[model samples]
Target: SLHNSGLSGHNIKIGIMDTGFDTSHVAFARMRSENRILTTRNFLDGGNDVMGVPGGQRRHGTEVLSVIGGFDEGNLIGTAFGASFVLAKTESLTAEIQAEEDYWVAASEWMESLGVDIISSSLGYIDWYDTTQLNGHTAIITQAADIANQLGVVVVNCAGNEGGNIHWRKVVPPADGDSVIAVGAVNTDGFVSYFSSQGPTADGRIKPDFCALGEQDRVAASDNGGYGFDNGTSFAAPLLAGGIALLLEEHPLWRISDILANLKRASSITNHPNNAQGWGIPNFVNAINMEPYSPQRSLLIITPQPARDSVVFNMIFSSASTAILTVYDLSGAKVQEWDETATEPSTVIKVWDGRNRSNDKVASGIYICVFRVGDNNIRQKLAYFSR
Candidate 1:
């Protein structure tokens, strides 16, 4: 719904890991066919044809890409409608879909090689992943996704459509990865889709970190001629991925971890997400506007880039100055906020045990410190390593 905000990914590069792309799709390529795609690869066939080698392809990837980067002005528009892309044909159209976890891992590394800022994967591995490995840290693909997180590349994935079934009670692998933003599907009515997978990884972490409009979503066809309605968590995931692209466009300096955290904070629920709807739906505009990590210069100095147990900072200003010291999680939630008056040369601010406003200690991760100094908001990064 943030479409009117006028945010576009422009120079940001997003990597699409799915069945493959339809190079001919106008959603990707306009009349002159200029901004449709950038680099592509077919990991399945080991070929340069990422626009799905017809026999080796399916329209799935094309539609997925359309949900993110497709642009046709009034006719259609994706979240990052103008963003560039790197398409990886990691999935096969074979009878079994023929995609193993290794192909996905290799493609992920390839995306990293191309320096993609975000990886939007509508793919999940379930065939070979045993139920025991559904824990957040298990599964080869899950580990690979964590690697992408380590590299600062935001990873988003579908939470699978296995909800309606009794046999499969949770989201598929890779989606179970804690570091990945696993997305579920919701209808326009704000109801969880019947087929959207449920979760709670085997390790007891919330799966499908968020949900998006997925049921009967209007989608671009691979033929590039007409649009049709599609339904699945796949579509929902890309829609959010595109939103993140738009966010990254405005705050290029934002850390991926912050983005992930802010996304949860800005979601409809804001806290205590359930597996059915994850953090509920995200408000795209709120998400972008809530990124408090965007830096501005100030006399405030946050000591210890990476902090453990506590964080100390010095606020220096001409004459005595009064300011608001706030701590916000990635989702822009004010974990801790208080008014401060720096009357001396150095009015030091120290946070012991990383507790928030409620006095509950924050978990080990990244946080943003915002100093509402005078008329400007200056921000600093704080990292916590749990004891």
Candidate 2:
């Protein structure tokens, strides 16, 4: 059925960062037969040892890769059937720590060099062994994310599965990186999984930007035998990554940020976003059919670094029309609204006194400014700091 519909993730290349993959596995046999696999690298050992445990540790990466592009019988079908892949082993089965994060950085750099369309990782780190070595802080590792974004590669990461069980809540890096699409896990019924991490990052940005089915999902096994079912934010993330690969195939010219913005826009909870489901579950079909996103003609903050009390929003439009600006805090609660009636095509500067409509100073954190001009809407994030 995956091939019958002609949705074979074709011409798209995805870079996967995880434990080693089982190259000899059956799920990828067709791809190997067709030479669809682009390249394989092991950032962990600097060797080409990508086969998981030579036959044992292959299950995890096999399942992850299958979720993104595996093809099989009536059992399960991946979102991107035509997509090719490059495997980058960044995690070690023995230890998960800050050093793994460094390996991921190296892997991502390699992915960019290959001009991959997307980077999907089922890895996240919250509590490293050495807290001093932790790179969860926003200021530290966001640069890596920024570089990936600038290279026109969409980065998708999993929010850690630590919500109900852990004290240090929220997603891990590079999921914590503002530019990455930090994904959370939900079930077929669309309920947030109890183990899905919660967030409003340390800098106060709503994370785990979207959710996907993670519970009891079918995945390919490295045994060259059959499929296995599992649950984790790991499974949820690749479902989205697979869907994104399809979207990119359809809209090749769209920027990574535009794709991300449209995904957030087409999510199930565009209006009622929260920490558990940032923009909610992304709708792949809707994202593909939607109008092409033009970030330039929408509302944007051209910067003075972080917005102090007053900030200017550059408004761009092709036709003269009325524009409405609404500001919301990290909790998705509306704090302010400004209306500009029948404005000409030009830039409009709107200032907030760092206070809510009730004349109260809003707490220092991250806020979203949404601008609506006719049917086109744009949203931008602004950081607020208070002494």
Candidate 3:
């Protein structure tokens, strides 16, 4: 029933960075024919050998892609069918750190140049074949990660599968980057997976920012010619990545941070956030329905800190008179309304004091400020930390 909205990720560009993808595979044939796959690059070889040899091995990238963008029926469906994709092979069967990490960085730059809306990397680096090549304690949060975040590209990485273990249980590299959305794994029943990584990063920030279904999740298989089952934060990352494409398609102007914040707000844990679930599982429907998530326009501003008094809002609208504004409480209660009046041309600014029609101070807490401008709507957070 989640797909009932029929809001496929049409026209968005998504980059899948992982090991080689088997383009020859039937699951991806349609994508190639329709030009849904914009281009393919292999940072691993610096050549066009994107397809692995005809064996059950080296197909991890293909499987991950199928989960995120594959289109099939009587089988698993991708989160974003209409979105276009760019394939970047940054990992290999060997999973070496130096080469793979270098490949990922280059691939990320290439994706940014192509203006990709999102990058879904099912790859992670913790232990390397060469012990000397291991990323040091600081590298996990620095070099590899910091560069990706600087590009303003939404990067989603899998939290490593080291849960239920005592050593190296946290996420690594790009996932450790403050800007990246590090994903953990959970079962269909919404319980955290035994293999899902845990954290409060080395710096002590809640990690595995969110989770998705990973235990026995469905994905396209290279040999079976149909959907198959798999598990891991690796699989979970793409599901969220695909969902992000849909979110981007629906609200294109959202900055990576805005999209992330709104997702956290709409996640199952808004009422009870913790390390295991971070902000909790993302609800695509709720994400789309929420205002302040408009697909167009890049900036959102809320004013008057003590919203208990009053507040003013300023926003950039794609066109004049295309937006409607409303206010709601944390409990999803509509406390105030702003009619859809024709906004003047150019950047429009509106003002709202915290008092309702009864002209009394609003209670202290969090509030939702929604803007509905034509098909584009966005919701911003307004906080009233004190009475």
Candidate 4:
């Protein structure tokens, strides 16, 4: 979709977290010529060189980068070749270690400090971890990803390649993170790949929020300095991340929630998401052309602001869910609260008659109106003037 639009993720900074990279590949020649590789970090050794050992370890990272930023006329054109990049070597494919999680967390912090707008993580952790811990809040990496999301970084992670396994076939963390966009694999025909991990997190939340081409996907071959095809959810993650970069390039001020909501709204399966394919595959054309995402779409909206008698709180969400609307004074005191459920994909309107919990008229100058749904929290300012 970005091909003809002249939109190529220009000026967008994306952090790639993988084993390592080999920037010498010809596929990345254009990017190298343009100096689009902003910086690099090797969390595994605290070094600056992200190109680690010259074997299979760095190859994965190289191929992942190629899928996002590589460019070769008549050969391979990445989803966002014009975007800038920051590479981080955060894993060792040959080593089975527990500290890998810490490495990922450290890399995330470093990337955030470098002002990366998005993080494309093609790695996942499941070793020595229990299936029950697939809950978003359990894994340390998931917690770190959540923190990154709160800091306004869009984290895109692979949904793991464990679908064929019967023992434990769930998504890995930080893919389990609520705020992270976990991407699964799909074939060229847009069918779910057999290797893409399933979702429905241990906490009953949808995991792999999106899907992308992963089977036989084209990637730069680091060893041969050419292009090749790869099959894994690892490839799918970066593909989706590259598309996200294009969107962010167009909408620089959009937040994580806004991006996710728009992606869901533009996905192949808008409604009924499941563990196998969360919201299905995303279409870049549909997403970019849709209405610009705003926090009010599924967050909170205060109507009749600077009200004289009463105020209405309009809380919208993608689906039917229960939420709590609480009003707090400037002094951090609770003024009033209401609990209501939206029975459908529509607005849940709650009216307040300028009264506190005591049902008595209260004098209010400025107050904070907060509406919380699931893991999303939105706040709006409300002003009340007595009649």
**Total clashing pairs in model 3:** 16
Worst 10 residues of 3 by lDDT: 128-137
Cα RMSD (Å) per model?
A: 11.2, 13.0, 13.8, 9.8
- In angstroms, the error of model 4 at 275 is 1.0
* Tens-digit lDDT string for candidate 2 (126-209): 554322322344423445766666555788888878787656666766777777888899988999999988787766678888
Clashing pairs in 2: 8-81, 8-82, 9-82, 9-83, 10-82
Model 3 misplaced stretches (Cα beyond 4 Å): 128-137, 140-145, 293-345, 348-387
lDDT of each: 0.78, 0.75, 0.72, 0.85
The lDDT-based order of candidates, best leading, equals 4, 1, 2, 3
What tens digits encode model 1's per-residue C-alpha lDDT throughout 1-387?
556766778777788888877767667665226544677788888887876445336688878888887778766788888688888877866645435568889988877656577899988877666667788787888898987776557899999998987778689878998889999999999999999998888888887899999988777776545688799999999999989988888877676666877888888987778979888898877777774543333455766656778787676554466788887765568888777776754555555568777888788766667777777565565667767
Task: State model 2's lDDT.
Answer: 0.75
lDDT of 4: 0.85
Q: Model 3, range 35-128, lDDT digits (tens) per residue?
A: 8988888777778667757655446887888888777766767777677898887776754667677677778767765657678888777664
lDDT of 4 by residue, 278-369 (tens): 99998888887766565444667677766788898878776888888888775569988888788778977778789889888888576767
TM-score of structure candidate 4: 0.77
